[model samples]
Target: MEKQHSFWEREEWLKPPDLMIIGGGIVGASTAIFYKKRFPKHDVILVDKGIAPEGASTRNAGFACIGSVSEHLADLAVSGGETVFSRIVRRWNGLQLLRETCGDEVMDYQNTGGYEIFTDEKIYETCAGKIPWFNQKLKERLGLEDVYSEREYEGYPAIFNRVEGAINSGKLMRFLHERFTESGVRTWWNSRVERVEPGSVMFENGFQINPKKTVIAVNGFVQRLVNLPVKPARGFVFVTKPIPGLKWKGTFHFDEGYVYFRNIGERLLLGGGRNVAKEEETTDQFGTNQKIKEYLTRFANVTLNLPEKWEIDVEWSGIMGMTDNKEPVLQEVKPGLWAAAGLSGMGIAIGMQLAKELVSKLED
Candidate 1:
């Protein structure tokens, strides 16, 4: 079929915007929202490749949390205490900002709290030992005392985080889209950006416009657009049919946040087996790995102790942008072209806050 464009459509495509944002995921949407707030009168447009904000934004497990107890301790080992604590603070603050920005009701946010469970006694004991130190260190940053408490949950030894929560990712993204629409910011969904330049955005459909400034927030799809220190790590998430007598509630993590699950109503949503098949799961392609899926299936029943015979209702995958250091990769690649990608599966926690920081730098 021939590509169709009305007279007005052609005019709209040809006109230059004051700011052009590529990608419409949480980071891109957040960037546009922040841009408009900074320059309301200026023309800012968001172009998304999918029908809506695609990739991880609309396709994550919906945990509005940062690192769990063991995960934070492991991070401290790798990046040291200062770097790890600073990141945790940013992620904690980001979740609050998102809750405040989108409002708790519309985003379906639940501060029902979160927990990190461990099957291994050794790891559990190590993590439990750090609770006091972590609580004391983090209290000064997050201003919330007693952040982590060692306890038993659902028959498993777990470390509970008082402030961690979950949010409906769809609702949160919709809230952002609505904010942009209500604020008169133009959004172009189904627009595939081919390349990004200092002041120009070229689409796969042969549409090109030279906006005064451009921001690339494409996340996992960043390789084609820029030479950033990032790569794709695919993740799978599956939901179970409502099981009778479901006892689990609130967000959970195991194996240092690699495996996570939570209750959506009476049903269970579980995901994360990238650690099982690291090489196979490191692609931008969107498909579930068989080994990973099988591992998660057994994990749900055996490890999580969920009732057997509970059928999976749906299964899907998302590509996450990751860096070696696992921190968000934000850089001004060129004079007027900036790229903010590599959220390292922390998009829900850090995407918006990164955009806020990016905009401040953009204005500078």
Candidate 2:
């Protein structure tokens, strides 16, 4: 005898879709939204392995940045000048797309600006030396002059990027989910996609879905689903309770953009120091490193000068996919199994634009 199936489950929920998107983060969600807008009548469904939109999209520091000076220089060395410039353009344009799609008020986007500081004199001089060239290049790309400015704050030497800002990452992800759903795309939450082939996905719950097109948007967890030229880089973050007078009011980066901290309206959110444990930080596991966590804590106390008695309100880890080239992969991994991985820690900055590019490449 055949297993019982409800009418709603057979005709609606379990029905195969024209397009299936794996991993419901910013990229996956935005892809569904864009693809539906292009083909309004197409049936699209997005599924994520977790209950919530995990990964770096909802876990990022909420920075709307186009790479810091040293970060750009580093990428240029690894990925070359042209590629770095183009990546910067994508990230910049992606932020615009995100803002326009979600609206500023909904995401709580703050144009508070960002600053990069250095504690090492050698490193400071190295990055500061590239200020002129970076300003010129960024100006050419962004239509803005004097993008990078040198300044000092609270005994820290820093370079301020006027165009860079921060947003509420949680709110942004919520907005993406709501907006995509409103665009007529269905979503399957807590659905674990265990494996994928050319046209189908196998969920761990013993269910299968065959889609005409499947796009794997799982950034860091790509290894779990398929073989891709990407590796997971884990990061840990902590937010403190509301302090009386938290002077830091904007986003900040240090030590080659690995360390970041910002004020969330009197409460301080800080993370990074993966460099302190690069070997251990390479895993995709969602947990904090003791050494790295302790380092950041000390930095908070000694350098950040947070009141010694302030308590940590919350803390967690996020996994991000990074490629050796520091470039995102938006290629057709298999015949009809296209994938977008390796955002290289810039997922929040470039995920939407990458989705747009990927959607445009598809045949309607």
Candidate 3:
């Protein structure tokens, strides 16, 4: 039995809106703000399943990085040089938009630089050989020479990216939440959308919302709503207790970004390695696997060489939406129904930008 709302309450809060965006994650919330900004007279509403921003938006590792050296090289191998270059440009644009919309200070954004550690001599040599070529291509696009510099850190061999930075993921999401509220966009948390009709949305609680336009921004959870090409890829992460003298600083990626770690003040945050168990890690569940945990523990001990007795403070997993082509699907699926998913684990920077772009297209 569903509790019914009074006529006054229904008229005030349950009425149809001009734009209703599902999934109050980064993309969904930004989409609401963008639409409201473009159409001030229209009523925009954002609904989320959880009370807070669920999915990877708030659970990410907080690395404000575009792409690592080895990751870029792998992308180039698969998508070719031109396509890879264009994707990088989009990532740069996304970063700029994030900074412009939410001030750097509010997001706790910092340009402390980033690094990629080579685990072996062969890998180091292979990446070193391609550094010159890769640097030239990136410099051409960025209009700056020597974006990456090969360096030695402690006993580990690494390459440094001068343009990389870090941010507090919590702060960034909260900042966006506040901005959305200030912009007069209505947000309904704990509202799980069950079905989407042509001009209405059916909620799990038996309530229906008839909005003029609906945007589905659910990333990893898209399969539950639509039959799209998007699939959920799980990423596990763990953090260590504060170390008094941690040698590593800034963000880091190893083995083509399958493994990454970064320092947050005195504590260290490490994540990734879904590539090791691709089949098991493809589910949308947010649980840890013993095999993956063992691998991460070994990497932290051997690769990062953290001191013994450093406690595992916390561990969690996030699901990222990925596609075969590694490109986000940002288009109108049907009449008055739009979607933005398939970020491929690169959603932090690019998701907000895609929202703005989608809003512009919808307005036009």
Candidate 4:
């Protein structure tokens, strides 16, 4: 049964807000923060279906990276040098913005560096040959020198990115949430959105709000509300039981970043194999793909060469939005309706910056 609102609730708390932000992930929270800071007098409310962010924002592998050498080469081929280099700059600047907004200590950010390991010698050689060019371009763009260097790790050919690192995803989101509340933005949890029209949004629970403006920041789930080019890609992750002598302690990627792993103290956290079965993984639903899991399991055993009997302690999957060009989608879908999504699995690196830019557009 619907509980009718009292006079105080209807007139005050239940009244339509100045802005309604759907989806409480990094984009939504950052949007609220920027907007509230700009207009403290206006009431803003952010709603999410889960108690916490349900998408890749908090569920990701916590890799604070721009792009690996091999990944960049592949992207450069498809997107051209100019587009690829511009994206690299955006990612680098976005990472800086995230660290500045939520402090390094608060998020347990570590400059442990990132390594792109390769088992195929030919692929490794090709990537290594492009290191100097990549370094020169990155230096010119980001004012950072020696960004990529050829290296060897555990007997495998690797290219180390000196600027890349890792962070605690949960803590990052927690800090963002604290900032969201501090900025006087209201939050409505477990409130799944049923529909988002031009002027009003209806919740799954039958509650309706007619806000002056609405922003959809659901990422992978954006398609559920409106038609867009963004598509959902499910990625799986698993953390192993404490390995007594785990030595690898930094972010690592392979197979053009289709697979990645890192160390959390004495335990190994591995994720990403969606490229193994792209068609199957391209759905909004959340579940593990056995084929991808099998591939990753083989990689952990054969490529990573873990302890003889290492075991997975926990495993889960997260849904991320993907675009053909691997760029975020930020635009007004219709009058009074806007959307910001398709972070392309780089939410940690670009979510905040994208939010800031979106807020600027909303201002106009």
Q: Please give, for residues 209-264, the per-residue lDDT of candidate 3 as tens digits.
A: 79989999999888888778999999999989998898878889899888999998
- The lDDT of model 1 is 0.89
Per-residue lDDT of model 1, residues 41-144, tens digit only: 98888888888877899999999897898888777778888888889988988988887888899989899789888899999999999889998988788788
Instruction: List lDDT for all candidates, in order.
Output: 0.89, 0.88, 0.87, 0.92
Residue 241 CA displacement from its true place in model 2, Å = 0.7
Query: Whole-model lDDT for model 2 versus the true structure?
Result: 0.88
> After superposition, which runs of candidate 2 have C-alpha atoms over 4 Å from their true positions?
1-3
Judge candidate 4 at residue 303 and give its lDDT. Answer: 89
Q: How many residue pairs collide in each prediction? A: 0, 0, 0, 0
Candidate 4 has a TM-score of 0.98
| TM-scores of all candidate predictions against the true structure | 0.96, 0.96, 0.97, 0.98
lDDT (tens digit, per residue) of candidate 2 on 210-273: 8888999999999999999999999899999999988888999887788899999999999989
Candidate 4, residues 14-104, lDDT tens digits: the string is: 7988899999889999999999988889999999999888988888999999999989988988899888999999999999999998889
Angstrom error at residue 103, model 2: 1.7
| Cα lDDT for residue 295, candidate 3 | 95
Model 4: residue 124 alpha-carbon error in angstroms: 0.6
CA error at residue 42 for candidate 1, angstroms: 1.0
Sort the predicted structures by TM-score, highest score first.
4, 3, 2, 1
Clashing pairs in 2: none
Better of 1 and 3 by TM-score: 3
